[model samples]
Target: MCQRMQMPIITSRYWNMVHGTNPKEVQQDAEGMQVMQVLGNNMAFGLNCKNVAMKMGLSMPEEPEFTYTNFIH
Candidate 1:
């Protein structure tokens, strides 16, 4: 969805998901925790870069009008 909207997508070392039936189980997933940390860092870095660019007068391109097509119709 973000890609369709031309929004930046942040990625990590693996699929952004954690397997758990509860909070405690999730906390025990070492690999998932690492992925989350990487994702957080990536997001922070991307935001910082965007902020610096804006400060320098750089901006994203204007979005074009979107057209929706109904397959059922």
Candidate 2:
């Protein structure tokens, strides 16, 4: 979806996954929480940047040329 929408994908120090069946157990997963926090922070940073750019009247980059091919044919 990010690729399709031309949005930058933010990555964290670790994959965002909490291996637990319950909320308490999931919360106990410290590493997962950290990763989620990182992801959230990155997203917030991105949004802030975009907002600043808009406020400064900065233009967005042009969309790249896209070509579709039917490989199955």
Candidate 3:
């Protein structure tokens, strides 16, 4: 769904999920923490790129136009 809208989806070496029943357990999940860090870095990079492009007057893609309709009554 995000791909369809041209949005940047941050990815990591593994799924961003931690299986823990308590805060301490979650804090010990190294992989999950790494995934979160990677996601944050990616988000920052993407935002920086957009900022630079805007400063350079690079054109951003136009938003898609659409109409919504009710299919079920």
> Candidate 2: minimum summed lDDT over ten consecutive residues — where?
1-10
- The model with the greatest lDDT is 1
lDDT of model 3 at position 68: 95
For candidate 2, the per-residue lDDT at 46 reads 84
Say which prediction, candidate 2 or candidate 3, comes out ahead on TM-score: 2
TM-scores for all candidates: the values are 0.83, 0.81, 0.71
Q: Give the per-residue lDDT of model 3 (tens digit) for 1-73.
A: 1213366676766787876799899889988888888877887988898889879998677767667999999
Model 3, stretches more than 4 Å misplaced?
Answer: 1-6, 69-73
2 versus 3: better lDDT goes to: 2
Evaluate model 2: give its TM-score. Answer: 0.81
* Native RMSD of candidate 1 (Å): 4.0
TM-score of 1: 0.83
Q: Rate the local accuracy (lDDT) of all candidates.
A: 0.87, 0.81, 0.77
Which residue pairs collide, candidate 1? Answer: none
Candidate 2 lDDT tens digits, 3-70: 23376887778887777789999899998988899999998998898889879998677667878989
Please report how far candidate 1 places residue 30 from its true position, in Å. Answer: 0.3
